[model samples]
Target: MVDVGTTLEMVQASQAGMSALGAGLAVGLTGIGAGIAEMAIGSAAVGATAENRDVFGLVLLLTVIPETIVIFGLVVALLLLF
Candidate 1:
């Protein structure tokens, strides 16, 4: 009983929904990945800083490196949505 136009519209709507889902997944997974990386890096940074005061700056820089991954993911998701 479905007409061609209705079927086409339904397919288009489904595609858009899937695209949104993919964007959400991309951002979510990247955030999780960043968190995991930061967890291990933070522990090491603390240990290094405890041992040597001068290394605190280096450790801080290293700890923030993983943040870029999440930023990139956000950009990708935005691109997908727009």
Candidate 2:
């Protein structure tokens, strides 16, 4: 055979690259989610202000929903690390 060990090393390297990519995806996806959440919050805040200016509390909670995405992403990243 044509020295299969080198081919194995190449496959391992590719796997390593994939792991790195997974980490990047976690953070990137979370960032996208966070951005979306912020947009919703902004819209709600605007609407609340226009309506009664007293629903800031409810809007704040709704805005924080996106943060869960980041939290989940972080957990995935941490799991991958170890």
Candidate 3:
């Protein structure tokens, strides 16, 4: 027969595993999304900057904006883990 304590420990372990998986997915998926977003913006920014050097600063800002999604994802992962 299985011991009750052992069963409880197993359940806790499974829960911990699931939490970790969730955290990993949160960070990984967001990073992927941010990367995709950056790809499009980066290409457009490059084109715009090439056409008008004066817009380089704005282009740079636009390029960096997608990175905020990664930060948000990190926060969510931390929350999930903790």
Candidate 4:
């Protein structure tokens, strides 16, 4: 026979675990999405930079844009954990 207090503790622990899992998923999925986005953009950026040196600045800016997704994910994870 389980006491009410014990059951409540178990529920709280499970909730904490779920929160952690959600936070992990949030960061991992966003990081993966950002990586996929960067893969195509990076390839094109490299090709463009190869053809025109003057376009290197624009290519670099475009290449870095996808990284923002990861940053947003980190923020979400932090929010979840806190």
- RMSD of each candidate relative to the true structure: 3.1, 3.6, 3.2, 3.1
Best by TM-score: 4
Q: For residues 1-82, write the lDDT of model 2, one tens digit per residue.
A: 2345568777877777777788779978998989887897878787887898688777778878788888888888777665
Please, what is the TM-score per model?
A: 0.79, 0.69, 0.83, 0.85
Lowest summed-lDDT stretch of 10 residues in model 1? 1-10
RMSD of 1: 3.1
Mind giving the per-residue lDDT tens digits that candidate 3 earns over 1-82? Answer: 4456677778878888888998899889999999999999999999998999999999999999988988998898899888
Clashing pairs in 1: none
lDDT scores of the candidates, listed in order: 0.89, 0.80, 0.90, 0.89
* Model 3 score (lDDT): 0.90
- Ranking of candidates on TM-score, top first: 4, 3, 1, 2
Worst 10 residues of 3 by lDDT: 1-10
Model 4 scores a TM of: 0.85
Per-residue error for 36 in candidate 4, Å, reads: 0.8
Better of 2 and 4 by lDDT: 4
lDDT agreement of model 2 with the native: 0.80
Model 4 Cα shift for residue 78 (angstroms): 0.6
Summarize candidate 4's per-residue lDDT along 1-82 as a digit string, tens digits. Answer: 4456687778878878888998999899999999999999999999998999999999989998988988998898899889
